[model samples]
Target: MSAAAFIRITRPHNAVVAGLTALIGYLIATGTLTPPSLLLAVIVALITAGGNVINDVCDVDIDRINRPDRPIPAGEISLGGARAYAAALFIAGIAIAALTPPLCLAIAVINSSILVAYAVRLKRIPVLGNGAVAYLTASVFLFGGAFAGIEGLVRNLSLAAITFLATIARELLKDAEDVDGDAAGGARTLPMIVGVQRTGIFAFACACGAVVVSLLPSGDWWGLLYLAGIAVVDLVILFGAFRGLRCTTPGCVRESGATSILRMGMFAALAVFAIAAVI
Candidate 1:
């Protein structure tokens, strides 16, 4: 297998972004950066990479239809190789976490377990699967904040909540996009159960919740810069969510671009949070 295939299988870009989120979390918690913050970023990145790899392994069949170009489906990597890579990454992440604090170690262990579970079984469920991914995304903040103790964790809670809602909305929309592949794989995703139209509405509702929660940290504490940036972020998210309303059928939703728009909003929000933390 090519080295690029291994990297692609891990979805390294997504892992790096998740790493940045953990760094932002630490920055927000302590208002300063430390070696530990960098360590947490690496740990999160490694674990996220591992999770992505394992997910690819578990999703080989689905990927054949939904993502034919993926490493596994494209024959760039074998299932055995992907599984070993995942285990290595997870072990490395947990080992690094052990160097921090007990809290960090605990979160590392728990998140790793959840990631495996999500790939192996949870992803076949409906809303539960969406919720699992949402929680894992939000937990990066918690993992970063663990460096500063309970106070740090508490400070990051609002951010975690906003992220959780937005992630769930995106996950639901993604389910709609993958309905055919998921159905063929015998998976019971939300859109498969309630229809794409209803799933779109649920996604919209979750997006609204995310927008509301995102505003909670504005004003003097986060500064007007954050307020202004978050306003734009919320608008983009809401607009993306509004577009979901037009997706009446599975075929329509698959090509709607609503999910991609929502993902842009998320990346925008991440940038805003990082900039605010630094300034």
Candidate 2:
């Protein structure tokens, strides 16, 4: 396989972000940066990349219709080859998790299974598919926390909740964006059920939910600095929501800008979380 094919299939950018996410959890739960934590974070990132590859494999036909430039549809990577690569990555990631601790091992096995199931079948369900993706995104926090012996779990859980809701919002927007491809591929997504404009409204509401979740607990855990940083995060989310509200029905066919804003906001929120822990 060509290096470009492997890179395209893995979506290295997302894998890097996944690594950073695990690193944040490790730092939060461990109370000190450690080499082993970093290593485990890398392993988790690889597993995420593997999941991306499998997703591409399953979406080959849909991608050909909606995303013709993708590796599988573009003829840059074979489905069988991608599957084998994903399996190897899953094994490598699980082995590392297994070596860490029991909790880590359990999480790895469950997450890996869920990844496969999501790509193969669950992704065709209506909002349920989005929920599965949100949960998987949230679990990254727990995965890193498990490595730290479960200390400071409350904080990690809080972060996980924030990530989950935020991810749900983004996933919904994505569903709206891919409605065309989904329809061609026989998916029963929210947009297909309720229409694109309604789906955008739903996505906006979910972002609002994330904002509310972020504000919970008052001053019990976070201080003014955290609140201040979260304000910026909330603003970013609000912008995306506003755009969703303003965009016409046809606009829902491609929510690229709104979706990108949500991703940026998530990264900014993570940064806020990391910074506030120290300040």
Candidate 3:
């Protein structure tokens, strides 16, 4: 494969999201710089990369229709080759986590299973698929804590729940954006079932709810700050959604911009949370 094809298959941009998840775990577990925490970050990134690869392999046909530029769909990489790469990455990720702790290994196994399931079947199941993705997104942070040997899982449950909800909101909105392609592919996403406008509204509500949940006393003022920041971003996204609803064509540029803003805002929040934990 050419260099560009390799990059496309790896989906380097998406790796940031996985790295951020590992960062969350490191912060919650150590609250300070440590070797093990760094290792956990690498492990999480590997796992996330593997998951993305597998997802691409599974969605090659749909991607050929909606995102023909993607590696597998664009014929830059064979589906079989992508599957082999995914399997290797998944095993490597699990091995790395296993070195950290038993709990980390267990979490890794569960995470791998969930990703496989989503790629194989759950991804076509509408809200359930979205929920599963969101749940896994939240689990990244929790899994980080496990790798770091953090005690009292309950202490972080609230934060995890908020993150899960926020991710779910984003996932739903994304589905709404890709409704046309998904419909053609026979995928029953939220927008396919409830219409794009309703899905947009529901996504906005979920984002608002996530912000509210973050405001609850979680003993982390910094986390609250992150939530407040997220709320501001969400408001902007809401306005964009409103515009999309009113416009005849629903500009893809506006929707993409809103999603980018949300992602950046979430990363900012995670950074703040990490800083707060250390201080």
Candidate 4:
């Protein structure tokens, strides 16, 4: 495969962001950086890259319609090549995690397995698929916090909660965007079963839920900086969700850029948490 094809299939931007988010979690929980913390970040990035590659491998058919420009559907990379690359990344991540604490190793194994499962089967199961992806995204923080012990986990719980809810909202909107491709691929996603309008409502509710959670005691405990920063991020997320809700068709939702907006909001929230913890 070409270098660009490898990068495209791996989605290096997202992998890098996931690694940075984990580093932020480590910083928040420990208030100090260490060599092992860097290792954790690397491992998370590798696993995330693996997950993206594997997802593309499994979604080739769906992507052919919804995202024909993607690496696989565009014929930039072969399926066998993508699968081998994904396996290598996953193995590398798990091998590195094995050198860390036992908890981290456990998390790495479980998360890798879940990523594979999500690609192979869970993604066709509607709400369960959304929940799985949400948990996986939120768990990156938890994985970083694992290095610091139970107190670290407790400290990062609110961050995880906000991430989880927002991810659900984004995932649902993505399902809406991919409704046509998913239906053609014989997948019964939420947007297909419950209808696009109701799915949009569900996504809106999840975004609102994330916003509410950002105001809870756990969030306040981080002080006004966090709350203030999150307030701006939450507004963006809410606006995205509102736009999603107003769209009854996949084409409209895609044109609205609801998923992209929510993704940016989530990345901003991670930055907010990092900034609040540092300051």
Candidate 5:
């Protein structure tokens, strides 16, 4: 396989971002940066890369219609090759976690299983899929906390909750965006089952919940800098929510635009978290 195809299968950019999330969690728990935290970040990245590749392998057929440019769909990478690559990464990630705390090893194994399940089946079942994604996102924080043994419980939980809620919102919006494609693939997403308008409302509610929870972290573990940064993030998130709310009917929502805005907001929120954690 070409190097580009291999890289494409891993979705390295997304994996790196997820790894950074683990680093954030580790820093919060330890209240300091260290080599062990870096190791945890690397482990998470490997696992995320495996997950993304497995997901692509599972969806190769669907992607032929919805996303033909992806490596597998484009025939740049074979499904068998992708599966083998993912297995190697998962084994590496779990082995590394096993070298750390026992809890970390358990989390790695569980998360790995969940990722496989999500790619194989859970992701076709609407809310179950969204919850799976959100839970995995939240687990990044919990996995970090496992290393240090509950020292940063409150902050980590708050971070996890915020990530969980925001991810649900994004997942809901993404389901709406992919409704047509998912429907063609026989997937039963919320938007496909309940129509886009109601799905939009549900997504808005989740986003609003995340915004509210984001505020709770302030004046406690975070200071004015965090509040200031979070306020901007909140505004961006609210923009997405407001746009989502305006979708009063099934066809009014441009799910792509809505999904994009929410993605930006979530990344911005993460940035705010990093700023708060240090400054």
Candidate 6:
């Protein structure tokens, strides 16, 4: 396969999201050089990459309408080829996870199940589909801790829950941005059902709530600093939402800059948490 075909099949930009998930796991594990930690990160990355491929395969038609320049839609790659690529990535991920630890393997299975569900059925449903994606995204960190044999399941659980809610909010805002494409494809997203304005409001509330929760845990000044920074990012996101509401343009909503800021904030927060954990 050519380099162009590879890029088309892998969707490198989405791969960064997957890598971030694995990075969260690695940071929590805090064992950067350890074999188990490295293996765990690899597993998570492969699984996430596979999931992305599957998502594109599942959304080929929608993408054709929404993103005609995409590989499958643009005829740079065939649907069959995409499915094969996804299968390869999924198998590789599972193999890596199984080699890591029991907990990591179990989480990998669960993650894969959820991704399949999303591609097959859940993605068609409003709100529920987005929730599954968000929840899975948060699971990467918990999976990391598990790999480290940290008996912090409860904390990880709490983090996962909060992350899930936060991700849902982001997903909703994203839906608002893609309203036209989703609507054209008959996708029943939150924004499609509730209207973009209402969805934006809901997302802002979720973002605020996440910021508050991040700051709730005491013991660590670094974590607090991270949370404070995140709060500022949340404020910017809120501003974007309000602007989108006023503009009512897909471009405005989609390009709101909230997603990037939130991602950066989450990474910073995780880094601070890792530092606090060490100290």
Candidate whose TM-score is highest: 5
* CA error at residue 148 for candidate 5, angstroms: 2.2
Two-way TM-score contest, 4 vs 5, winner:
5
TM-score to true structure, per model: 0.88, 0.87, 0.81, 0.86, 0.88, 0.81
Clashes by residue pair, model 3 = none
Ranking by lDDT: 4, 1, 5, 2, 3, 6
Off by over 4 Å in 4: 1-8, 60-84, 219-221
Write candidate 6's Cα lDDT for 1-279 as tens digits.
Answer: 355875656666666566566656555445343544566656776777788788888888888877888788888778888898888888888887877668778888988889878998998889888889888878887887687665534345545655766777778877888889777767788877778778877877776676666656643233655565545645654554455445355577767665555555555556556655555
Give a tens-digit lDDT track for model 4, residues 80-171: 98999999999999999988888888989999999999999998798999999999999998988887877787778877998999999999
Candidate 3: tens digits of C-alpha lDDT, residues 216-277: 66644446555666456556545544444432222552455545655554665565566556
Q: After superposition, which runs of candidate 5 have C-alpha atoms over 4 Å from their true positions?
A: 66-69, 73-77, 217-220, 223-225, 248-251
Clashing pairs in 6: none
Each model's lDDT: 0.86, 0.80, 0.70, 0.88, 0.82, 0.70
Clashing pairs in 2: none
Clashes of each: 0, 0, 0, 0, 0, 0
> What's the ranking of the predictions by TM-score, best on top?
5, 1, 2, 4, 3, 6
By lDDT, the best candidate is: 4
Per residue, candidate 2 scores C-alpha lDDT tens digits across 25-139 of 8776655677778766777888998899999988887789879999888888788989999999899888888778788789888988999999999987888889999998988
Residue pair clashes in candidate 5: none
**For candidate 3, what is the TM-score?**
0.81
For candidate 5, what is the lDDT? 0.82
How displaced is residue 83 in candidate 6, in Å?
A: 1.9
Where in model 6 is the C-alpha error above 4 Å?
A: 1-4, 29-33, 66-68, 74-76, 150-155, 218-257
